[model samples]
Target chain A: MRKEVRVAGFGGQGVILAGVILAQASGAIEGREVAQTQSYGPEARGGAARCDVVISDKRILYPKVRQADLLLAMSQPALAKYAVDLDAAKGKVVIDSTLVNELPDGLPPVYRVPATKIAEEEFKNRIVANMVMLGALARVDDVVAYDSLKRAVAENVAPKFRDLNLAALDRGYQAVEGPGLRPAAGANDAPGAPASGGR
Target chain B: MSEDGRKVRIIQGNEASVEGAIAAGCRFFAGYPITPASEIAELMSRRLPPVGGTFLQMEDEIASINAVIGASWGGAKACTASSGPGISLMQEGVGYAAETETPCVVINVMRGGPATGQPTISSQQDIYQARYGGHGDYEIIALVPSSAQEAYDLTIKAFNLAEEFRVPVYLLSDEIVGHTRERVVMGGPIEVRERVAPPKEGYRPYAAGPDGLLPGMPAFNDGYRLLVEGQHHDERGIRAGDDVNKSAALVQRLNDKVRKNIDRITDVERVDLDDAEVAVVCFGSTARPALEAVQSAREKGVKAGALRLRVIWPFPEKVVAELAGRARTLIVPEMNIGKLVLEVRRSAGGRAEVISLPRLGGALHTPEEVEGAIMDAVKGGNAR
Candidate 1:
């Protein structure tokens, strides 16, 4: 099966790092094929930056996300800009609700995790918001195995931030169960969040 | 790491190149940082030093290429990396390397441009520039990697070819392939070819042996009197600008050395092309989407296939002609306006209808987009 995940936020939110961890979890730990690409050129500071991770049992043909199965929108503008291309019925969006004041209409199931709030409150650092969202993504969708993500975090993160990153991933993973994973890979209507139709 | 719990590493495309270069005994790296390609220089800075290699961040791209050439002459496997704008600046140095028969590798992590067009975006626009960038008639090996693993494998190939052929070799990649992260399996016991040293007796710096390659390149201060002149010179490395026969022979041999070995130097991947009436010809990161499109078209019962160029330069003419002979239509897709498509047209030779699907300063061709082009090619039904 092919799964494409896109993590988007402003420049300094560790969006790219989060995608790398997801890729490492799937590719390096689980031994699957993964390709990660990002919006890395001349993106202005504070602009909407994004990284795309394509995970597959077979070789990933196209590297970039064609239709994102999961969208981790850490900023309000990121959601506004990238939500249009999210898989309408099957896709899932995990947003940092503390920063996102509102949600666009007609998106797939959105799990509002308030990643920034949790990162600041529990970890004492707001920069780990991307990791929090990734953790929530694991619990909310099971795109990657939760244990592998923890392992990936341990292996990929900097020495200074490794402990905090693991804790942040665990906190997000344990707090919520991916309503989509309970049954099968196909994401269904779960009890955790409402499926938005209109504003 | 492999299924047996071997070392399966997740690395970016640029990082893979560094690992490959290190594996191939490349100990010298000189470059200037450029967007989308800076990571290569950054990683090389950390990578080369630990391997007992040297890393030099020169003042500019020209100095970077020149330094690489100098290092190569100093008897170290050397390379440099840059994007389009910076690579354009290295044209004179590249020519000098070609003229001097310097063995070095230059990685062009291509971006959009005639100038510094799109430092943040990706393009295959430099395809022609790499082959014919300098002022003289010369040929250089250009390998275009479609994935991160290929990036690693081809980089080692680039260094090996540079040393064996005594010509500057290029790994023509784009920002997408350069910056994308993927799994690269490190192979066991990488084979490396070092430049052959000459015998003590009767060694001329610019003279070709019976094998059509220079006898040998002596390291600087290696007990050999080497002039290292870039001007048209005789076998003794002395300027022979006034000697027509010597100048002609020297230049011809430089081009002939690579041309004669084209069969051994070229590599390509063919997918579902057997008995297909329509085929998509592509390279670099664009190849993946084109393959998907061709596969999807086959599901819909269209006789379509894909050909991906692993080695870009040497043109791979025989394969293109063979594909053109069977397939009635050839679709050439590139991230540039029209570079590889032009070569495809030339090689197709009106045997098949050649179509160019060009994109610029932007994203890769989506499978859907390439599928649409394939469908159109099939519908057009232009026969040979």
Candidate 2:
């Protein structure tokens, strides 16, 4: 199976790192063909940043993502910019409910996770929010094995933060189990409605 | 794999190039940092020390190229890398390396051109610059790689060719190929080329052997008296001082050393060209999309094929001419504004219809774009 994934957020959200870990999990640990590319403006931080990871069973002919099969948005601007490019009929969308308060109408199946809230409240660090999103992605999609992702996170993170990041990942994986966390009711559903009913 | 049994690893192209250089026995690196090419310098700084090699971040591109040449004469396999603007500053130094017959590698991770255009974007705009950037009539070998694996593999080939031919060789990469990450098989036993050393007894540095090529070099401070200069010199390394015949012969020999070995130096990856009616000639990152376009065209019964030029300089004229003779139409797509297509037209020699599909402004040609051009060429329509 060929899967094209895009992870987008501001520069400091560790969006590029999340993409790298995904690529490693699928390619190095799982022995699959993968290509990862990232782009950002001149600003070092606070500017929009995005990464594209293409995982395939066969040789990848084109490296860039023409239409993303999985879209992970960590900010309002990133979702507004890239959500339209997702494959509407079959694509899966994941968004951080803590930062992104709005969702477009008539979207594909969307999984909303309180990634930043879990990192900030449980781990006392908001920086591990990307790891939380990764965990949720693993739970939502069977693109890569959960064990492979755990190993990848261990290998990619620094020694000091490895334990905290892994904890964040586990919490993220469990976030999808709460009730009323499916796709929003309709296009006109209230903003921030998905996260209020869940812990 | 090496004897230690290290397997494949996913790495960026710039990192792969460094590994390739290290595998090729390159012991010295000097370069100034530039965007899209800076990763090469960063990795070299970290990796060279562990291997007991030397890495120097020179003050600028001018100093970097000169240092590379000096290290080459110091009996070390040396190289330097930069992007377009930095490469522009190193032109005089590159010319000096050519004149002195220094065996060194110069990598230009090409970007959008003319000035400091598009540092983060990729472009094939340096095709002319790689060939004619340095002044005077001289020849240099240039290799263009399409993937990160080739970026690793061809860098070793670049160094080997540089040492074997005793000339400056270029690995013409672009931002896309340098920055993209892919699976590159690491840890292989590579054949490292040894620099030819001159006989200790009465060696002349500039003397050409019976084949009219440069002889083995005597290392500096190796108890052999050697005078290296950029001026016109004779077999005994003495200044010829505007002696028209001697200077003309020296210049001719310098050019002939590479031109005579053109057949051995040229390499092209031809795909699906057995009965192609339309052919696309491309190189570097652009070849990726061209390959897909050719496959798509074949599916549509267009009989489309592709000839990817692995060696851009020394211009694979013979292969191109043969392909042109067999195919009715030739489409040349590049990331620049029709620089290499002119060479393709000249090589085609009116044997076929040569079309230039030039895409500029820091964007690559999609497979759809190339496929549309191929279809247009097959219909004998003038399409840009």
Candidate 3:
């Protein structure tokens, strides 16, 4: 089974960076085969940026994710744009409670987290919202160990921002790692274990 | 044979290529996916992470090649793979690596194209592009693998050739070879081709010595102030030529390293061509049919042989010229209208009658067609 996820939001919302951190954790740290692709043109401003990450043991046939198992939409536009591609029966959707005003109809089990509110109220850094989103993705997918994801964030972020990123990740983890959250079906599995290495 | 390692298995051409890159000690990959070549990016994305390496799918083909360049300097063996349209976008990056003498591998899985011609159809139209698409007067090593097994073996060779010469190597394949389903013998850990990392001190990124070619480059963050770009530059990698003589000399030297070392880079599998009166020259998938054609001709006492060009670039002029001396006729069969045939014509030196047998699209030339061409060439009177 492959864990295919997409993180989408405005350029500065750290969607691409969030995807990178998860990819590194699942792919590099966990020793799974991982493919991460991002979409961006010359307009690096407020344009929408989407990153696709596919983690599988067998060789991934296509890097472009046609159907996403997990979708993290940090804004309304992201939710509206990618909601149709989500497999409602088998997928999971996480939205930022602050930016997303209403959940789309016929969506997967939507988990709402006040990512921006947490980043503003506690972390005091807007960029840290991605960290919260990452934590939420971990809670929803459990594709990689929460500790492994934290380690990936610590190793990937610039030295100056590493401390805040790790703190934000832990805070996000603490918020959703409890009993009320939906259990991940393929949870606690190593990323790209040998048995699943090649297709 | 298996203990000697690098055996084969039943694998797709793209998977074979990924395994081959790893066997060649390629630890970094940065690429964007396009059809017919997406499997390469997919495989690298997963494989690089486990070995403490990095796999990045950049924003586009341009960024993909650029990031590969960045990672190469970051002291990682780097590579990228793409189909026709994406490769067209990567020409600038290819020129950049050639100018900087940055060692990396770029795999171009050829598909029918002038502009998005056919993403999934096989064609060898990129032969000239592989040699001339990059912007400057530079030479590159391009290897063409005919089968999945060769795809695996040649990717390793591509990395070795790239590092040994300090230039970008091209594992040039068509959609047929890229997506072909064949039993690839993939066995024990093969001997990987590792780059000769530069010394700690006295490392100039482009210090071409009396031999007049750049040396093995040092990595970035390695204390060496490495200067790199896509300009006609001196040994210091600083843009040094606005005049004809300097630019001409630089181009000559860049061309010389591989042009001079053809025996090493030009891997031609000559099957019974030693004393044949007719020669069939081909590369990639076409060569398989061409080989059968040659065998059938010999059975009919036509004295025909086949030369499969495993390495497409560097042209193998000397070998072709030598083989031309012994053969009375050289039949050049390729998938494209006529690309590599021109190279063969020039190298055959008018000693042998050079004939071109062309095809296009997903229509593969059958062994009977190639046999007919060989027979027709043999029957013709232009035996110079």
Output the number of the TM-score-best candidate.
1
List model 3 lDDT by residue over B250-365, tens digit each.
Answer: 78888888788778777899988877888999899788778878888889988889888999898999999999898988988888888788999999989888999989774567
Error of 2 at A39 (Å): 1.3
**Predicted candidate 3, C-alpha RMSD:** 14.3
Reported per model, the fraction of native interface contacts reproduced equals 0.93, 0.55, 0.00
List model 1 lDDT by residue over A23-70, tens digit each: 999998998999999885366567678999999998888888878999
Q: Write the per-residue lDDT of candidate 2 for residues B227-325, one digit (tens) a residue.
A: 888888988778884899989988898888888889999999989999998999999999988999999999988889999999998899989999989
**Against the true structure, what is each candidate's TM-score?**
0.94, 0.93, 0.64
Off by over 4 Å in 1: A41-44, A174-199, B1-6, B382-384
lDDT of 1 by residue, B1-384 (tens): 355443558898898899889888899999999987898999999988878999999999999999999999899999999998899899999999999999999999988887778887888888999999999888899999988888999999999899888899999988888888998887676778867778757778887877788766689877877889988999889999889998888888889898888888879998998988989999998998999998899999998998989998889998999899999999999998888888899999999999999998668899999999998877789532
Location of the lowest summed lDDT over 10 successive residues in candidate 2 chain B: B375-384
Report RMSD for candidate 2. 4.4
Ranked candidates, highest lDDT first = 2, 1, 3
DockQ of each: 0.73, 0.60, 0.02
